[model samples]
Target: MCGKRWILDNKTLLREYIKKYRYFSLNNVVQSIGIKRCVAIKYLQLFKSEKIVFSAGRGFYTSEGREFIYPKISRVIKIRQLIIKEFPNLDFIIWNTLYFQPYYHHQQTHNITVVEVEYDGIQSVVEIISRFYRNVITESKRKLCTSEFDITNDPIIVRPFIRRSPRDGNEPRLEKMLVDIYIINYKYKIMADVDFWELWRSLFSLYRIDFSKLIDYAVGRRNMRVLISQLIDNAGLKEVIFDSKYDLLSNMTRKKGGRCRDGKTRHKTVGIIEKRNTI
Candidate 1:
């Protein structure tokens, strides 16, 4: 699609249009610019390279530099296809460490594929996956942290699905993946003493994270402490906290174990937490 062609004569008009609209889709650009979809896409890629336009999500663009890096779902698609071939009705989410490669410092040589299934179907899914793949561990916390289960060897960890996990279809949303990585690092030291704050900073700087959804999922996993710490340390993130609808950080600081104002634990669902206090 990015093949060499006549230089975009409409680049200035495209920039002005995006600046005025703030948020737009590919079709919107095509209609407004009166250009072929492929031609517009090629120009858009050029604009993105020049840091003139940013990806808000799939087929979505913004003038603001906050680019939303969508996870590459080819592997997830293949795994889902395989799982669906046998258990056509099973509920699961498939994600891998490779999605995070864009935000991290070093190019990761090792990858971990995480397959999360509902309680009853965990074993079945693991069994099905084990047939095609090696080093499959089923809900084994010890195995994840042990030397015997080398993560560098490309291991597959099957976990029980969290209720109401934030997702983009069958794969985790960026928010859910961020929370999961923090919790995984806390529990199993999976990232191996890597600087998490920097990791999160890179992620937040690159993607359009839904703070409310991220916090909600973190609370569900009982892993808000790490997030809270990162926010406290970074003044810019604290500003984001105030800007976001998720003002529960103050209340969270007062209450332990992710309790709400009514003294009940936070719900598993995202974007449902009511605002109580400001931080």
Candidate 2:
């Protein structure tokens, strides 16, 4: 009876773990839970068969119905890994639309991937990627602005920007993704106003956004302060703005070199913050 109870409890624990974490590797489960490797594999197989969990490439698994559908960018992971292996000295951030998957629901019919590297190495990196994938083509700055679409060849947009923060592996963090999306929307004018707001609402609701990190990234960018301020107001997430550990409004004002508005002064900001926390 004790052995049977242990088995049942382990199964329940595994289910709860997957539900909370959303994704896990087989080794992660075995090491963290102290389950024997073979036993863990068997349990995982059972879970998969029962539709409680699903495989997410190799040994990774995610809870059923909760798995995020990463955007389709062919060989993205492999390409990133290869780049790191070949160029140990280079600093770059490689990601596709997969980073924004959690914020919006859409089919990835267009193949647009961005490879951002240091300012000097843009052409070199593009050449390297093209060598690896023969069909891939680099878009020129003029072409990026003027050309609408290219369905014939695989297009990899190469951009050179000053690397602000260290690469967080091969992917940018959520804060970086948000800032990038904001910039892209401003430059491309692709996302509709309603769609943009809906995306922001979904992101704020689903993720623990680091407002400080976001502000840090957006500080130097032109019109970013206004964009963020408007987003906060339009989302009706005034409570989030006030509850954030950093004084968001003051930070924006300082960045913009503007005097604080009546409701945006330090004392008023503090009062609003306190009021929201109390509620």
Candidate 3:
């Protein structure tokens, strides 16, 4: 076969082979197609560019090629601009809850901008932001429940940054946002268990979330075990990251019945995570 015709024919065959497995490794493709490892990797890259396949971590490729859509950051950038103009050297991260509206079942009615600045600059950052924004809170989530303060009114929360929080440029990434929201809800009861699980389910089904990155952020926040238990029991994400180092947690979960002592029943939303079909 000529080189061009051979490439075209092999590409068609590869697509057909890929359709048989929801998730497959490079070895699976090489052995099944009787191709070299280098050739299989080349083909996988072509498939990725064509939106026919996507990396699912741990050397696995998934045929479901749903791309992660970045939230609109125009408003976030405006806030960042205001902060940067004041303290050009300040190291900080800024994000808003309004970015998560599409991932929730019931639309979130309120918008809260969170500004996490370095320890040395947090007080000054808060002072600068307070001059422009009326509904600004500094370092106290306890005040969120006060009758005097209305959370529904868009609030700007200025807090000190923790070392090693995940970021995309000057804004928090999806991984960081997931961990923070989960921990906040765990501590404050801002949303019911059922509602929280539903939001996670919707997000997992629609977006390409980095499970490992999310876990790392949760670990930094000292909520790794709590978050992983919720992921396996409540969100039914065990199978999604089964190949990860968290595989041992699956056994622990079964032995413990994966129940939290809070007395509120956690409903497991399953089948949203893509299954691994035999190659």
Candidate 4:
């Protein structure tokens, strides 16, 4: 572990704490978080990578000046966690059943975090994981992966690969089921960019993580995005679309009471004479 320390995930009052305030201001952003001023600033910098907020003026001001606005749109992490937490077991059920894949069990987990922060307000953090195969490459190309038709600029996103750990096998551990799911659904722009600095500020204050490398690498937003893209492929997603009309028809009709649709017009079967004869 690096000389830096990270806080353990705090299980208490996730909502109550978030609701009290929306963003932490400069006067408070540093003071509020226990980390040294420099470290706190570093965390805040990370949140900026997700584009959750921006500086309002010179010097530190608030989460707003420092910029820590939360996303207004509902995101998968909040939505899924909220729904699952209601049932307790249902939460794990949904995550493991739908989100978590078998291959994820082996690799380390990395979070694509987004934070929307405001100065002196409660800050929100969103974490996402890639649901597809993210191959590891020697060099990283950030912009291609991070920026996607305004997606990286969006309030929430990224295809965070499974956390990497020492692996005996050379194989890239990606979930087959996830590859299938991402190809068909839940695979758009990797939910790109959340407020990273706010998260560092907020989370770092309460807890700690070895974020030095992450902080440095994530600085170049485009580089981060491109690097992330290599881990997952958006091009392969086309496979989700059917190649044959027969397959499309089968998909449309195979379900019970599924919306019945026909691509081809039955020229002969719909002869007007048939209806006239019946009348």
lDDT of 1 at 9: 56
Scored by Cα lDDT, where does model 4 land?
A: 0.28
Q: Between prediction 1 and prediction 2, which has the larger TM-score?
A: 1
| Predicted candidate 3 versus true structure: per-residue lDDT over 156-192, tens digit per residue | 7777787778777786767788787776566445566
**Alpha-carbon error at 179 in model 1, in Å?**
0.6
What Cα-based lDDT does every candidate model obtain? Answer: 0.67, 0.60, 0.67, 0.28
Candidate rank order under TM-score: 3, 1, 2, 4
With candidate 2 superimposed using the best TM-score fit, by how many Å does residue 67's alpha carbon deviate from the native?
A: 14
Question: What digit string (tens of lDDT, one per residue) describes model 2 on residues 16-79?
Answer: 7777665456766777788788878888999889888775434556563442234555567877
Specify the poorest-scoring 10-residue window by lDDT in model 2: 270-279
Candidate 4 lDDT tens digits, 1-279: 333224222212222222333322333444444446665555456555545434422222222322111223234355445434443332111121122321232321332222111211111112222222122111122322323323223222322222231111312112222222232123332322222222223432332122222212222221223322322233221122222323222322222232225744343312321232210
TM-scores for all predictions: 0.62, 0.56, 0.67, 0.18
**Number of clashing pairs, model 2?**
0
Model 2 bad stretches (over 4 Å): 1-74, 105-108, 132-144, 148-154, 242-247, 251-279
**Which ten residues in a row are the worst by lDDT in model 4?**
116-125
Backbone clash numbers for all candidates listed: 0, 0, 0, 59
Of candidates 4 and 1, the better by TM-score: 1
Model 1 ranges off by over 4 Å:
1-67, 71-75, 140-148, 192-194, 234-236, 242-279
For candidate 4, the per-residue lDDT at 30 reads 40
| Model 1 per-residue lDDT at 89 | 85
Q: What lDDT does model 3 reach?
A: 0.67
